[model samples]
Target: MRIIIAGAGDVGFHLAKLLAYEAHDINIIDMDDDRLQYISNHLDVHTTKGNSTSYRVLEEAQISKADLLIAVTESETTNISTSIIGKHLGAKKTIARVSNTEYIQRKDILDLKDIGIDEVISPESLAAKEIKRLLKESALTDTFDFEKGVLSLVGISIDEESELKDKTLVETAYLNPEYSFITVAILRGEETIIPHGDNKFMLNDHAYFICQPNGVERVLDLAGKQRESIKNLMILGGSKIGIQAARQLSKKYNIKLIEQDRDKCFELADTLPNTMIINGDGRDVELLKEEGIDDMDAFIAVTGNSETNMISSLVAKNHNVPKTISLVENMDYIHLSQNIGVDTMINKKLIAASFIFRYIRKGQVLNLTTIHGVDAEIVEFEVKEGSKILDAELRNLDFPQSALIGGVIRGGKGITARGNFMFEPKDRVVVLSKPECIRKVESYFK
Candidate 1:
């Protein structure tokens, strides 16, 4: 795809990096020469050192012939205006990254789509929604639902107590004889492994499983984790993500929010009537104790500083908080979350990029998502009529070694894909694939 991206900031840079892997014709525009230079030096993309809102700059980037134009500049106004102008300049689709929650919640009133913007993404809102989902399933490191709640992909770490820790994939088959769930991928240290029959689970390995709705608890038990219900949440940072999470989860859980800035704390108190807003430093261990960190079922740190978020989450974990989620903007730090013992780590840029990449995928893919720090993707594809996938059992197919068919949803029933299982036409197949093997995996559905 011939894609033009406005801004060379984190979101735009990350999106460009993802699309560049697919060999897309990417053109990035930015006002800062240094940012543009960084992108050009690191990525195989055309960089234009100019404001994206300028028609002359857009023309220079060949926006008229672009398949998609993404506006993710820091300024919300700039992003919106660039998307609108790019759409008018003949881009087929335009996406604007917005910060204002009102622009997303009140979309019907604003109707930016009618004016040419095709989509509006709010990173903060997306992060908050992710936080809410993580809290709901406190035991799992990651969770993603496919086809509503029919099937889900969950990640859990293997510890010394895990029954499957030293067992190979085939040896653990007896644990779930009903075929309710399947382990798709394993993250050991920094390596992402698409598991096979001989692959044995090890300590500290992050195992990802695809299972039916009722199989969640079974998977948790196999990983030596018990399902915990979270009713008390303490959020550090009054940023958009923290405030949004508090607003959404206040009714369901007891929420206490701490903000370093006194003015922001008062603003949060005004907006979030149900949440207790405290004016104190989240990094202060004494203040956290005084505010009852130990009593919190889940502690979430969404502070702007990555170090602060990480340190505070560690403190919560030290205090025996069952669930600790930290928002780390630096993508490099995400891989350390599981290694350092944090429950979950989130990056708004990565979340937003993955959400947008779903629209770029080809074939019959119904849904697609990338794990927090893992180098693989969970993609759902529909088995089409007369496709080769439906002709034989999974074991007989020439499937990619770097990918695995985790589960299949047939006739609205979720089934864990086994070696003897045969695909049916119209069945939804969820496959976990590495970046290098995604194209090979997608070819079968095509």
Candidate 2:
């Protein structure tokens, strides 16, 4: 696909890198020469330095022949205008990134689709939704529901006390006699491992599993983690992401928000009637304890500064808080999730890029999800008639070594993919694949 990106910022660069890996023709446009130069130095995509809203610049980037145009230039107005104009310039599809929740929530009144933006995404809103989902299963490092709750992918760090720490998958078979879930992937320090029966999970390894509806708890047990229900919550910062999370999660949990700006605190108090707003520094350890950090079920740090968020979360962890989630703006900080002792580190731009990438691939995929901080993707493919996959059992398919069929949803029922299982036409097959071999994995489904 020939794609044109309207920004060379984090989100646009990430989307370009993902598309570039697939050997797509990608051209990035931005006003900053340094950003475009950095993108050109690292990625194989072409870069054009200019305002994307300008028709001449769009023409220079060859937008008329572009399959997709993405606008994520940090300015909401610029993104919307660029997408609209890009669509008029003959781009097949356009996606706009926005910071205002109003654009996403009031889409019907805005008519963004009619104006030529085929899709719109708000990173702040998406991050808030992710925080709510992560809190549902507070014990796990990450929890993602697929196909509405029929399938789940859970990640947990292997600790010193984890039952599966030293045992290989074959030896740990007794731990899951019912086969409710399958070990899909493992994230060691810098490598993403596609697990086999002989793969042994080491301490500190982040293990991922694909489970049935009731398999989440089983996976929790296998990891030696006790389930805990979240009630009291604490959030740092009054930024859009922090405020949005408090607004959404306040209905079920007691919320206390801290903001360094006193005026912002008062505004937050007025905006969120249910949440308590405090004017204090989140980096102050004494303030955190005074505000009852020990009793808090979860600590969320979404401060504007990534350093403050990480340090505040570390302080909460030192206080024995059950869960600590930090909003990391730097893409490089995501890999330090557990290594730095924080439970979860999220980058909204990374999440937004992955979401848009999935939407772009909707034609070839039933569903696709990129696990945060993991170098693999879980993709759902609908098996078509006359596909080679339907002719033989899974074990005989000679599947890519870097990929694994995690589960299959057949006739609306979720089933764990076993070695002897044969796929049927129209079945939704879920596969976990590394980037290096994802294209080969997609071939079998095609």
Best by the TM-score measure? 2
Report the C-alpha lDDT of model 1 over 387-423, residue by residue, as the tens digit: 8787788999989998999898888888887789888
The digit string of per-residue lDDT tens for model 2 on 194-288 reads 99999999988989999998788898877888998899999999999999999999899999999999888879988999999999999999999
Residue 346 error, candidate 1, Å: 0.4
TM-score for every candidate vs. truth? Answer: 0.94, 0.96
- The 0-to-1 C-alpha lDDT of every candidate, in the order given, reads 0.88, 0.89
> Following a full C-alpha superposition, what root-mean-square deviation does model 1 have from the true structure?
2.0
- Residue runs of model 1 more than 4 Å from their true location after superposition: 31-44, 361-364
For every model shown, the clashing-pair count is 0, 0
